[model samples]
Target: MANPIKIIGASLSQNVRKPLAVAHHLGLDVESVMAAPGDDTIKAANPSGRIPAMDDNGFHLSESVAIMIYLAGKAGNALYPEDVQTRALVNQWLFWDVAHWTPAYQPIQFERAIKPMLDMGDPDETVVAAALAKFEREATLLNAALDGKDWLGGGEPTLADFAAGAGLTYAAPMELPLDDYPNIKAWNGRVMGLEGFKKTAQGQ
Candidate 1:
């Protein structure tokens, strides 16, 4: 196994869950060093002071997807896959998660769930409404893509699934409109059912 690595992030964070879930999927049982948002320690790990940075002994890696890819590679699993074409497709979805999918849900999560918990403020109805509209569009595309497939982009679950599906962690709390996207709803259940996902979901 690779030298025991330490994940720095809260358990509830969607990005933080990726490496933990990947470790669990690979049977690594890795430990994490909890660092919540706005923690100064996060700056040393990620210049942006983001959660989900990783320390592999002395080696450091920021970005959840990058850490996930490294963990998957270490595990010798095909979660990211090897075929050039397949890999490209997997990467495409990963990019989409970070760019399109994540952004769409972020406002909702912050405005609806997180803000209130942190005593930030009430959710902005205008933001929620706009996000909901955008979410519906993306969710529809994702739903159609997932049709008749057990996982995203076909075959077994990949980083794309984790990257995108993690947002659903806040789906209910943020009141994300999933009613119109049955395929996405069902796929999310399958992703959540994985033993690795279950084992690594709660942060210490």
Candidate 2:
């Protein structure tokens, strides 16, 4: 039997949730090695010291998207998909998350949630306002894409869902005000309702 996959990051992280969600969804024997930022142990594996690095045997991999793709390949599931077109669609959303979706949500999450937790001070209303504008614009685009679909990539949940929905993992705590985007809210409901998402991402 292969060694269990190692997830190197704290469970609280948005990026860590992606690969963790995929692993749980596939019923993989995965373990979290919980490293906070600046942990030299994790830095050795990923120079960036980023959360959510994966170690399968001795092969180390970083970046949540890359980690999810690798995990999906191991599980031989449709999460990443084998069909060229399907994989392309998943990759497109994954790239979109990194490029657009996450950037808008990160600032809001940091200000509204993480700061308060760390006693870092109150949220900057100006920063939250700016992020709210961006979030509204992006949420509209995303809600349209998810229209009449349970998942982003297609009928079934895929890596795209995990990557694209990572920010929503913080939605409740960050107070994202998702009432306007019914499609997005419903899609997130389905994703969070998954047994895997519940156990790994929702701590249920």
Candidate 3:
């Protein structure tokens, strides 16, 4: 018997959800470890002090984005496409979220929402507002890309949607209106309605 790919992370974290969702889409059997705050297990596995570290057949890997791409390539077509251009498009959005959206928006969302809940003081209003403003701008760019299409790269939901949606889930509590971006709204709804999406969202 092989050591199943062990996904260690807090289920509620968006970064962790990316690979988990991909696993569900690919129907792969994986062992999930719900690493919690103050838990030393994850810190030991990932020196960066992050969740979403994995042990794939003894090959230790960290970082959510890297895990996703590795799993997709291993799972093949279910999540990763064979077409070079399509694969490039998926990678493009995945990179965009990491380099642009996640870096810009997640800190504000965490500080504003999660921190206060954990008894941490409220985040600076100006900073949150500025981040949200920037988020809205990039969201508008996404809306434009979604114009008349069902998904980011076209009809079928690709890894791009998963990557982007995982990052965007931070907005779930904000209840922002999708009316301004009908296509995006539809896409989000579609992604969220997947088999394990609700389960994953609920920290399954």
How many clashing pairs per prediction, in order? 0, 0, 0
Residues 63-144, model 2: lDDT tens digits: 9999988888885677878889988998999999999999989999999888987899999989999998998889999999
The residue-level lDDT of candidate 1 at 108 comes to 90
* C-alpha lDDT (0 to 100) for residue 176 of candidate 1: 74
Q: Whole-model Cα lDDT per candidate?
A: 0.84, 0.86, 0.76
Q: TM-score for every candidate vs. truth?
A: 0.93, 0.95, 0.89
Stretches of model 2 off by over 4 angstroms after superposition: 202-204
How much is the lDDT of residue 120 in candidate 2? 100
TM-score of 1: 0.93
The collision pairs in model 2 are none
- Local distance difference test, candidate 3: 0.76
lDDT of candidate 1 over 7-116, digit per residue (tens): 88877788898888888878875777789875876767777888888887777889999999998888677788899988899999999988888888888988988898
62 Cα displacement, candidate 3 (Å): 1.2
For every candidate in turn, the CA RMSD to the true structure comes to 1.8, 1.3, 2.1
- lDDT per residue for candidate 3 within 1-204, as digits (tens), equals 887788888876888888888877777778888897446777767767687988777788888888888888784464667788887887888888888878667867687657766778867777777777777788888888888877776668777888888765756555355677677787888888776466687735
User: What ordering of candidates by TM-score runs from best to worst?
Assistant: 2, 1, 3
Candidate 3 colliding pairs: none
* lDDT measured at residue 72 in model 2 versus the true structure, 0 to 100: 87
